[model samples]
Target: MAHDHGHDHASSTRTRLAIAFAIIAVVLVVEVFGAWLSGSLALLADAGHMASDAIGLLVALVASVWATRPATDRHTFGFRRLEVLAALFNGVLLTVVAVVVAIEAVRRLTEADPHAPDGIPMLVVAGIGLLANVAAYLVLRGGDRRSMNMRGATLEVLGDLFGSIAAVVAGVVLLTTGFAAADAIASLVIAALIVPRAALLLRDVVRVLTESAPRETDVTLIREHLLETPEVVAVHDVHVWAITSGAPVFSAHVECEEAVFAEGRAGSMLERLGECLRGHFDVEHSTFQLEPAGHSEREEPAHR
Candidate 1:
């Protein structure tokens, strides 16, 4: 629960995401029109992919807004988890997009279609798309990349940007040399580039959804740091996890010598422990139970 996100940062992210969504939507409409005018199935397919990116951006925008809601009784963590889910959804979408592009590239390589789209129009439309994708990518690039939602949205925009580049390359080759295979080759290359990044994003998303500790935290190291404090006899039941990206939570039970408790030094120990977590581990939300040594031995077993 060490959520360091301030209202200003959240507000900024939401504004940029909204701008990206708007840019992508405008590009999608333009692509659809270009697809109709040229009757190029390739342009139409690209438009479909752009539409998917728009959806992904929209999802990220909505999730960001929801994550800002105040905590409730039923959901004390609020809706921050939605950002992780949106990121997972966007990751899956990116994988599907890469697979689809690969399959289409193979299709074009294996079979020749007689549509014979006008390369001039294709080039013009792709140029516009390339510019639009660039704008959207830059807007999202300003947001928090560590945030799963923002990262996912940024990846989608980046994928669209790659598509626009591939299209531009294909259009140039087709118009200049009438080499149709250029389109398929460009698509294959783009797909190859997208897969690795998509895999990395999905892996990060899975880490959060599975309740894994933040990558930066070292539980063993944290325990040793706690032990270094004076009068701390032992520590146990240590737990660490994240509510979302950049927000780590920690908890443990600290056993002190009986004299330390008798002297009523629990408050000072707790303050020192809290500072340790904040200063060393970058954890702001933590819970600790102060107990005398050997206290845990008298506790009942779980569910017994």
Candidate 2:
């Protein structure tokens, strides 16, 4: 029942992403035409943001499909990591887009010619775009943050929501004051707002793909917990990393005291230790080996 429920949830998420992608695509087309007609950079900037959102949604859809492929002998973990990779790519793409926006704003501000169009029409269009973005954001609100694929999409939605609001504000200000430069200035603000969030997502996804320890996991703390187990004497060569977003895998070497070895229950002791680790840390996958104090020097580091 639990497995079936999980499958159903995954299916629902895919359906939502598909719908959002369609909506964003339609909005992008409308905004592009609107910006062209009104000559409003703010509207154009929002359109560009919608384009990125479309790309992010597409990447998420592909990742979800790939994640369902059955595991094979050559790749035991199947294709789950592909989703994280896609998210990293999306983050990088967003960062680049932000940089371009910043550069364009600098040029316009220096030139002192914003080329602002009549503000009333731009304001109306921007307001509509903002409404669309808010709807899209709500659609993705139920996604699990632990899934980097879902998290990345959520971040993109948030960026679009903020971008739309900025464009609407700029349009309104320009319409009231004819401050043509307000549009360019809003573009710069939107760009700056997007950079840090995108960069943070990129950094986290890269760390997971590289097999670096998850930020929330402490190797020392994990080792200490193992050492405190009744029969364990020495613990070493511990490693921990994220299997995907929320799932974590841990492996380690432990030495049992001579007294415990005398009981001839090293295997059972190791089993209890595994349970303890899981119970304490919410770790789902573990590989632990037991050894007599000096039995067979510890092996080489485990490959990620």
Q: Determine the backbone clash count of candidate 2.
A: 0
For candidate 2, the lDDT comes to 0.83
Clashing pairs in 2: none
Best by TM-score: 2
lDDT of 1 by residue, 1-304 (tens): 3356588889999999999999989989998998788655556657767887888889989999999999999999899989988888877877787788788778778885634567888889989999999999999898997788898888877877887888888788889998777766766766775677679878888888788888888899999999999989888888888888888899898889888778888888899999999999889899999988887777775111
**Candidate 2 regions with alpha-carbon error over 4 angstroms:** 258-264, 296-304
TM-score of 2: 0.93
For candidate 2, write residues 172-199 as lDDT tens digits: 8987888989888888888887888798
TM-score of each: 0.90, 0.93
Worst 10 residues of 1 by lDDT: 295-304
**Candidate 2 all-Cα RMSD:** 2.3
